[model samples]
Target chain A: MTDAVSARERILARVRAAVANAPEAAAVARDYRTSHTADDPAAVLGLLHENLADYRAHVHRTAPDGLAALVAERLAERGARSVAVPPGLPDAWLAATDAVRRPDEPRLSPYALDGIDAVVTGCALAIAETGTIVLDGGPGQGRRALTLVPDLHVCVVLAPEQVVASVPLALPRLDPGRPLTWISGPSATSDIELDRVEGVHGPRTLEVILVTGG
Target chain B: MGMPSFPEAAREAVGDTTLRANLRHATHTIRDKRARAVAELDDWAALREAGKRIKDDTLRHLDTYLVRLEAAVTAAGGTVHWAADAAEANRIVTALVRATGETEVVKVKSMATQEIGLNEHLEAEGIAAYETDLAELIVQLGEDRPSHILVPAIHRNRAEIRDIFAEKMGSWGRPAPDGLSDTPAELAEAARLHLREKFLRAKVGISGANFMVAETGTLVVVESEGNGRMCLTLPETLISVVGIEKVVPSWRDLEVFLQTLPRSSTAERMNPYTSMWTGTTDEDGPSAFHLVLLDNGRTDALADEVGRQALRCIRCSACLNVCPVYERAGGHAYGSVYPGPIGAILTPQLRGTSSEIDASLPYASSLCGACYEVCPVAIDIPEVLVHLRERVAEEGGKGHRLEKAAIKAASWVLDRPNTLAAVERLASATRKVHPKRLPGPGARQWSDHRDLPELPAEPFRDWWRKNRP
Candidate 1:
């Protein structure tokens, strides 16, 4: 086979040759707003909560102190026996839970993650207009598989801080070097007769804990 | 061997009542929801326009952006390879998998891979490629071609899927439960169980991206199911075969597309899962990453002044959902990986109109203009179709020459007032002798489907004179 350099040079040459005399692209007119709503953090959080639930994700609100209890209660309510915790997750957040905690220190294998019932992670940003929670595998967020293979995902969003009004606002705050998984609702499909059915291969139930600092 | 042309294949699909009904029901359901989803955004027009501008700008400077993308990806610990066409891409991907010494690879649903016939190529090289998406799993198990862009098996109803699974599942891996039902939830559950094993065991993963950010070197795959997540993260090696046109300039430019794509495709404010990765991270996802930049016929399509706008398509399939031709004739009729109005204009331009199938594609549309209205990038599909039709006729044959001469004669007689009136009188006088269908040649195909209109008994002028006098 010919080497990579030749292929690279050839393909680029083809592109340059093709567009040599093509019309210059017009300037991008970004007349769209950054935030569809006003710049109020609280209102953005409210919209985020409403939009998340509109897509059928179970949404809840709590303060920093109540987070451990809320996470424990939500896990128990789902009858979950084990929860996967990312390496950097705060131990105190799950201090109140009786379920076995599986910390992903060396990275949980897919088989290992499969046995866990829920995963709890912090997010990079949440877009309110789209009801999306973007996880950049930051502190508290582990590998992408940890959130994916589990039957349920309990994501912790730092309200007012993590919430952005729209996609434009969310992109600037995120670091793209880290892997990002944006969960709008749980994994769902509209494939069968175009009927929207939630939960296929991803987490069946997504419980979002909006951590508001009082 | 030559494949059957578009009209030849379309005739079969259009005549199938079951396929027609299935496509009609599926397309109508998605079309209504897509309109509702698009109407929710107040800045949708601006968003759409920005999306077009961003794509146009990227295409205009594709070589520069592609070079920048390669450097960024390599800097972030991902190896990049460039493929000029399908065979080269398949060879690169196959060798990458071989290097890992693993035979089985899991795949996220990707149009680029399908366009290159990667699965078949992989199979030829002794690699087992498993399609992890639900609809893809159905099509793969049934040994069928994908009909629609988003929902590949839109031509198959729930019952047909159950039958495919119940019959084909045992040979692949886990068997479907005895006497499987056709319920959507139940079928989804079966697929979840059937594919989960492959996801857990797969050594190498393959995917195609929705958007590739050139500045950040980030690749994004927006999907409804978590199957993509499994293939992306669980595997040891990751290879993404992305079209060169999938690239955008920056993260800032990505915002406009993220807003428009989901609403236009599955008709949601956002899809269920959107995965973005720049390169390999420490024990987070894959240890090694290979970015295969594919330029198979994309540059050829990009060279067109009017038709290059087809490259602006994000594969949203909004046009497919509203397309009357696709709803009735179904996806397989287009005779390529891409189907519907976008396919009609794009398939010809990308692959060229040399083949009988590609040539027939331009005439597939009724020039109804519905596809243009709903197009996110505002591709003037009808205008491109007419342009392509001219090219097809330019490759003139005896039939076309006759067609041109006949049109000229008709126009000449119609232009003269006396000659036009004389012909009209002759037509009404001979109304009783006129055949129900054109007797021969020129419009035999047209008259086969439709009856010639009855002579108005008298041409309008004759009736007007008799009534007023």
Candidate 2:
């Protein structure tokens, strides 16, 4: 701890010495618009859907009533036999799915999550402009590892409410205290000659079901 | 620990056909896509300007933000440590790990840690630090220096990577699967499997953040792979060594950077994953979190008015991708953890121009201004390079006196119209005496790379006077 104390003082003193003559605020000329102009919320939602698909995330839109059915259909399509489900997720969200639901509990190891076919969770928020879904492990989103280890992830976004037009708009709505995971698309890598090949270490397949009715 | 100067190492790298091919293909591919991605945004220039301003504001008021960040992180139950230099950082980190009684640690991809050479220091103190990033793992296993900032092993192609994995992975941990091929997917799988066990068992995790919020003490790491997530979540004790300049005044200020960084670096709308956490949480990720604020050479760099712009760099490799020099000479030529255009400016400023390598770095760039063009934060790297060049000449005495005298004489002659005209006539009369190649030591150095422009037959000024009024 003493190591930190001395280093802190010395570093701060040096910093003070260095920037002493600098302007008081150097107030950022934040003239940049917060987001692209798309005044309509519906247009924002459409942009989110389009951008999500553009980023290669499988995007599907459905009413509240059809949400569970879409989830079930998506699981079937992904060939998932078992799904890792967080406890706080509404029970009805998975009522239609025949895939065995693996609820979050103690003794859930990273190894077990790896064996699970897919992970289904509700995101904290989604960014329309960048085509990103953010999961904070709040209710529906299980531990970070649950969504990560599995080969596929099906994230449900409550559009219009959970979606924002841009990153600036999204940051305020989200809680910083919680561990936030902003996913633009499925796990991807451009490591080889800048050739983007989706599906790497994280969930290779990302499916976003936009539940607009709720 | 022994490394050669930039000119010394870059000479070999320049002649390396394989490294050249790898860098050329990678840089060209990323550079074109980056342009298209950047073009998609209509307000890109505004965003870039805002990014620059935000960083300037933060750096100008760095002391205030740092103290606020320390308080916020402490309030959230995370301890913050300060390190004045690399040795201090290493000592504090090693002592923390030893106190935990852990012999091994899993690390997320972190440039700050790499810059401080933490892995070697930890090893010297009998602690094994595992690098889990796919590219970093390859570099570590192959015993190679990182050539590029984003992709540490950019000098190595897929086949070279596969061979490194096959030959070296076993001694480290889980060996690459039998008969590993050169495919990117296969290589990624080998890394995932080899590093997963280490991730699960390790009690200690080390990382560097992309941005740190002063308002909430939230540390954010923007990455693609799940390895960062695993290290962030699974470990009981997490240690993050971040540069002092990484902090922003507030979360709202963070908005400007998040927009520009991804597009500039990887040319993506958004990177695959972004992790943000505030100190420690109960019954959640890491119960114990430590933030090590590093100021190794940052204060020195900040003291400089013209050189301070280099600190605005977000570690995006866009400048490197677009740099003609970097595409040929590769990363190792910079002779520091950072490389390419950003490195050419940053390394010299941080390390000072005393070392041969540091002195050589200011001359590494062609001053083409491609780096300044694509810089998200608008770091004027060429300006800093020229600034550092003056410092190197004045202090390091690397600039030759003959070149200086020649430039002074040319200025004296050109300053007077009559003297300039007389000299032009003299040069035209003695054109044959000028020779096809310079007769001094410069002849060999000049002919080795390129040809002289035949002295242009006659000076442009004389031709203009004779033909026109």
Candidate 3:
């Protein structure tokens, strides 16, 4: 056997011997509240908006029909010359935008992605209690870099459908096999004198559009 | 030179006015914010209980969960390596980096790596390891030891950091901007520009995990700045060296910690970024992933029943913030990567009490019980400190022998009532002529910092008998 294999065996033996006379651990009691917020959908959506803004993410609410125009307006407001479009994003979402479209057909290199001015993608889910949005690299959500590299990220979250009330409720809905990124706000750091300063490395500007009605 | 005891080390720190002010400002700011954040959760007590229980369960069956975790990570196309101690772990990582023919690697700020001294070891073998997190970057550039767990350079103020960056950044890779100011925002921008070049060109990345799930084989990194994401996502070959006790039994266990850790560490609703990945992803992140399970001295700690709960720490640094002793003495006084209340108990167990520093660590606290109250896992640090003190005393040294002899003499006198009464009467008669301080080696040292209590005018037994009769 190799050295690594022998080491593994020895470590395991030590662990077993260490706990041989130990008493059984008490069963984990999970009586903690699953959702701190009420069960109403409007309340959950409202909480999500308040939290996202609390972390300095600019938030806006709009109807599904107004999303394309809203997306175009956000991009133009940021003065973005180019926007990276993730695979399977609805074609009409960018119909009204005149900015050059950079799709992830052949995945963009890190260097190339850095040059893009903005990225617009959909999310897998959003947690209200924590004000978090999780991206699983599914349909509208591209690879992690699509949202990470660009200076600006315009994330579209379909409300009432994709929003959850708490973290416990957010876990089971996520698939463990896929790569996940849970973003609460734009990149920030509290390293200097323990004072928080936003916009470090990840998308410095996070614009979230909560689409209320399909 | 031998390392000084905790008192010797703490005395110097207490005298430094600048360090005392820095610790006071930083710790006080976070303490208030953490209390408010925790108060928002009505069921915080239940969550803390569940977190403690889940970790207990995981440690109880660590062998089973580890084996299962290895299998799951393997099935997901990642290779698992086991390291029995720090030397072997360093050897494995060095060889892995050498295999890729890369002399440089980007790193996320991880306590496990700090515990093993990975960067120093790698540097000895001709590799350059760059720390990406903003606080870690400050420490690395300044060539200073980490004081706080979450914020390694908490000892530094804004001016000190700006000086370190301006003076050292050029030699590392990118230089700080000309005429750089001391503002936190400008300083952070300097780090972003410096690390971005390394991230874009890096072939290998090294990290440590906050949590590793046994059932799904997923690893989690909870971080504040975007630096963690850059290193974890940009590199081609990602290597994570995590302690053996980091594994949880299942994925659902994260719900408890996700709520508690953010509030406890940085006092935030949720940190800016958290990355979760299982093994390797095709064309998404790293193509090849390596998970190193490090044991160093954890199994030895596990063998000790009272000392084992130190393994449940999430490295939140909350205990360090509220500790009165830590506030005055600072993190460097603890003399290890782990510091404050957690370090006082943990360093002794992991490193053993043979050395002077380790022996003195258990006595570092005043037994105020602040650390116990703030601990998320509720490890009674004072209980473990007293238990370790018993073990230290039993080892039989000069001071302990004197203590034992003194205790024996007191017990003997108390057992004989007549002799005790005679002694009490003599003490009362000589009270005016008695010396202010006890004249002895051990007793003199004890009385140096504390006032000698005055002898009572009369013994309690005599007063009680006369009054009652």
lDDT agreement with native, every candidate? 0.90, 0.87, 0.92
Maximum-lDDT candidate: 3
Model 3 segments beyond 4 Å from truth?
A: B397-399, B406-469
Write the residue-wise lDDT of candidate 1 on B1-469 in tens digits: 1767777888899999999989988889888899999998888888888989999999999998999999899999999999989999999999999999999899999999999999999999999999988899999999999999999989999999999999999999999988789999889889899988998888899999999999989999999989999988999899999999999998899788898999999999999999999889988889999999998899898888888899999999999999988888888989899999999998888788887788889888899999999988888899999888777888863235765677789999988989999999999999899988876674787899998888888899988988995
**lDDT (10s digit) by residue, model 2, range A156-195:** 9997889889988888888887878899988777766666
RMSD after CA superposition, every candidate: 3.4, 2.3, 2.6
Clash pairs for candidate 1: none
Write down the TM-score of model 2's second chain: 0.94
Q: Is candidate 1 or candidate 2 better by TM-score?
A: 2
Task: Give candidate 1's TM-score.
Answer: 0.93
Query: After superposition, which runs of candidate 2 have C-alpha atoms over 4 Å from their true positions?
Result: A23-26, B396-399, B408-421, B428-434, B447-469
Model 2, docking class: medium
DockQ of 2: 0.68
Clashing pairs in 3: none
Backbone clashes in each candidate structure, one number apiece? 0, 0, 0
TM for candidate 3 is 0.95
Q: Whole-model lDDT for model 2 versus the true structure?
A: 0.87
